[model samples]
Target: MARNPERRTALVDAAIEVLADEGARGLTFRAVDARAGVPVGTSSNYFANRDDLFMQAAARITVRMTPDPAKVEEAMRPTPSRELVADLMRWLVQRMEDDRTGYLAMLELRLEATRRPALRNRLTQPVRANFDESARFHQEAGLPGDADAFLVLYLAMTGLLLEHFTLPGVLIGPENDLQAEATLNRLVGTVVTRVIPPS
Candidate 1:
């Protein structure tokens, strides 16, 4: 395979866009090359086969979706409380809005995985590790609630994002974005107990 790191990364990123736009069946070396503006057959040089391309695209999206380190630092600076937890959740929502394509690509990969056992095996560990790390982080950060809280919020927000991106009108109609913000806050509140203000 081609070994130029920068070029490889670009090819993978381009492949992600193709996967998001065209789904697994639509992903091809030519499509990726066109999307990346590279010469035809460039993607094939970087990737061994379609499976290689799919794995690389999945890895790229994982990096893209990871939480911002500076933002994590800022969140840690605050006293760990329910409000801070809510803020973190809001940050995730904001990220989805900003990187909608990456998330869509991830969703596409998930669908494709259902049909490809090798891809399924490749993805299972990272997805579980992310969840495990998230639970550990919540505990270490002294955030309100436990691993269960994080799990619930994670699943709820995943469902919300799926609906918001795939079928916007279903869950939060008309003013979708605005409703998503409010709905996220409510979800956090329900999962993590609210802080009572001093009278």
Candidate 2:
């Protein structure tokens, strides 16, 4: 409803932080306004309701998590191989690590979706599209795996991210030897068959 693109983006970004830090329950227009340092009613003006704000935050997380086009081009320039796939998986983990709040917000959205069917349906489109797009890209690029590989890795990575963020001690820290990079490489290697170049 509020048509200012920049302001809207800012408000949604702030909402993302609130969602991550405070969870869905803590996500209020007042919370968003305080996080954004805007007027108290600014978020209410921008969003139709809390559900609208949640949907917007969900959408924004996708945009924030998308890789840079230049980086994508660079990654794509290499011949598609299991090794390349591992590299890309590592890149994904790195991106999530770098944007921890964004990823955490996404996790919060996933939790919220379980309770709200409408929100679940709204979030499914992009999530499914992303999964399909990743599988399509892998096949189109001649990557050394089928759609199943992507699906398995997707599930594995989802678990990995969940543990890495919500319970870091589970996979990280001095007590644990299962580090993120090594664990991801192993996951990709196990899931994606190695492509042998012709002699």
Candidate 3:
């Protein structure tokens, strides 16, 4: 009935933590309120229902996980497009590694969406928007790749981030950050350097 942006944000963030820690099944208004350290019913005051809370949290996680624009611009300067793409991929992998829990929670939400048509429909828009925005950014940066190439890169990178962060030590090979970055670079290079066919 009233505006409480900060409280709503807090509730959504708490919901994310609970979703990540306890999976989608454990996400309730009560759990969110507890995680937010707010009084009982606080989460309900903000979110009308569990689905609302989850969808909001999913959007917030993407917002929090997006690359910083200033840094992206900085990386763009004095670097070739291929090299810049590698830099961008490195940044993306680092973000997932740093916020493993949030990403895990996002994955949980994605799985939950499959069973709920309404939620899946809501999520579809933002998912497409992400790809659209990425394609726009690549074009603006004068990158060699097209939206199609970036789409392929997105799919590959999503798998890489999901596996690398979700199950540490499962990837095998060297476990250090440099080695991981190198691997990401090669993967990114492969995508960015590929020749796109006429549309």
TM-score of every model versus the real structure: 0.90, 0.88, 0.85
lDDT tens digits, residue span 139-179, model 1: 88778776666677778778767887898667656766667
Greater TM-score among 1 and 3 belongs to: 1
lDDT of 2: 0.83
Residue 38 miss distance in model 1 (angstroms): 1.1
Prediction 3 global C-alpha lDDT: 0.77
lDDT (Cα, 0-100) at 78 in candidate 3 = 60
Determine which window of 10 residues in candidate 1 has minimal summed lDDT: 190-199
Q: Per-residue lDDT for 50-155 in model 2, tens only?
A: 9999999999999999899899999888877767887787788789989999999999999999999988998899999988888898778887756666677788
The better-scoring model by lDDT among 1 and 2 is 2
Instruction: Return the TM-score for candidate 3, rounded to 2 decimals.
Output: 0.85
Rank order by lDDT, top first? Answer: 2, 1, 3
In candidate 1, stretches whose alpha carbon ends up further than 4 angstroms from where it belongs are 176-199
Q: In model 3, which residue pairs have backbone atoms overlapping below 3 Å?
A: none
Candidate 3 on 103-129: residue-level lDDT in tens?
888899889999988878877888788
Compared with the true structure, the alpha-carbon lDDT of candidate 1 equals 0.81
- Provide the RMSD of all predictions against the true structure, rounded to 1 decimal: 3.0, 3.0, 3.2
